[model samples]
Target: MASRSSSAAAIGRAARSSGLPRRNRRRVRRLCNMAGPDLMKTKLYSVSPPVKAKATNASLSGPTRYSPGMSTSRGRASRHKKTFPVPPAPREFQQARSRATYERILAAALELYAEQGFHATQTPDIAERAGMSVGGLYRYFRDKHQIFRELVHRGLEQNRQAQDRMLAAAEAGLVAGETDLHRAIEGVVDWTWKALHPTPPDLLRTLAAMAYLDPAFAELTEQYDRYERKALSRLLAKLTSRKRVPSPLAAARLLDLVVPNVGIWTALHPDEARGVKEATVEMIYRYLADPPE
Candidate 1:
């Protein structure tokens, strides 16, 4: 108990030094205490598809470095190049009732995180929003950060699934020799643009803030960023008439990272949105169409 209290206090101090407001400091402290001191001392790795472990902060000395699928997290155990040695046991709920409650908490947290801002929203707020008590909420997640991480993971997975479907259609069209590669590229960009349309600016800002403030969150975003870029690269590889672009990844990066981010802001102005999309689409298609020396 003494050690745990000390760990929580240390985290609280870190939170304060990190410029978190009073309310959020309390929330951070509570979360640390709930997870216990061992949570900080533990070094994390990807366990399986859904379950993951925590990254070490052993002395709260530095930011946690996150490793996504098949990447090295920290030290190399051996020259075997194996990651996730000794897979960690799963943590997700197995029971139907628990699963329902768990989802309810995530659903409520998703709304509250955007509506109230992640820092401003407390665990109690999430519980209340989910029609549960603080104690019940604790049963599922140790802290709000855990909930945020889960939300991001699930969102990224959903996006990858969507991309898979889109790619499948494009590939099927290619097999039939009916796919206009340029048109398929435009469709992909348009799909990405529309996906961002309904999300309020507040949520986007919230995501940006989280990524800025938390190393783990930043790493989580980067993992998906890598995936999306690769997915874009795969699209171009299928084009038989494609020129020999010196760097295919560069082209992929522009479409995956640049277009959608810039396009989202253009959407803020409803009248100009259509024009901006057309201009951006043309820019992306042209960039991919021609190879740079």
Candidate 2:
């Protein structure tokens, strides 16, 4: 803890001496502090693999970032919209042993979901991975779906927090040092690509399958989209020079839908990723930046 604080303070001092615009410098200091250590490795927005049957591993790196801005408006509005069918964990998390058991189950489930996809990963598989009996697992979770639901919630929340941080940074006037639309889009693609890295293809496919079984999962997705679209719309309005945009809300919707799938797809098939990455950037850039009819 002391070392981490010292590192943040050192970065803060460096920013103070740097010739960057005062506002920009201040933003940098804030980001460094928010990120704590390993600033460069931390992505602008690290979206977990598409709802991972795994939805997401809550262990994704770096601290969550958000600020007072358009990025959080809809997020705040839809925060309470979804209701879980099962309690995330019926066990008391306050006890050390109980908390450890709960986390073990989740970690085990996340691994199995990645390896086998959501449907194929049974309670037994999770219990085996967690080194617990099936009956033991049930004491913490009523069923596997409940565990899945909890993971999806954690993953989505993590992704949302990262997205808000990225947008907030952008809104704070950090543009990845690009002014042109295509370059900006490329940078965006690159950042997302790095963040996604790789996720099992089967996990990517499981999002739809899981959504069917649990309407709550679908509801959570809808809620996220609503918040994401609004935030993206605000970003488009601010960044674009043209007075008229090609339905900024529509464009945001497209990105909010497309980016995760595209990311996961590319991660599993790196040979095809370059083409997909370019295509995604072009499609999104035109959708967001092109002049209105």
Record all residue pairs in model 2 with backbone atoms less than 3 Å apart, i.e. clashing. Answer: 51-55, 52-55
lDDT of 1 by residue, 100-127 (tens): 9988999999899778788788889999
Local distance difference test values of all predictions, in order? 0.68, 0.67
lDDT at residue 52 of model 1 (Cα atoms): 37
Predicted candidate 1, C-alpha RMSD = 15.1
* TM-score for each model: 0.66, 0.61
lDDT string for model 2 (88-131, tens) is 43445678998999999999998899778876777898999999
Off by over 4 Å in 2: 1-92, 174-184, 212-214, 241-246, 290-293
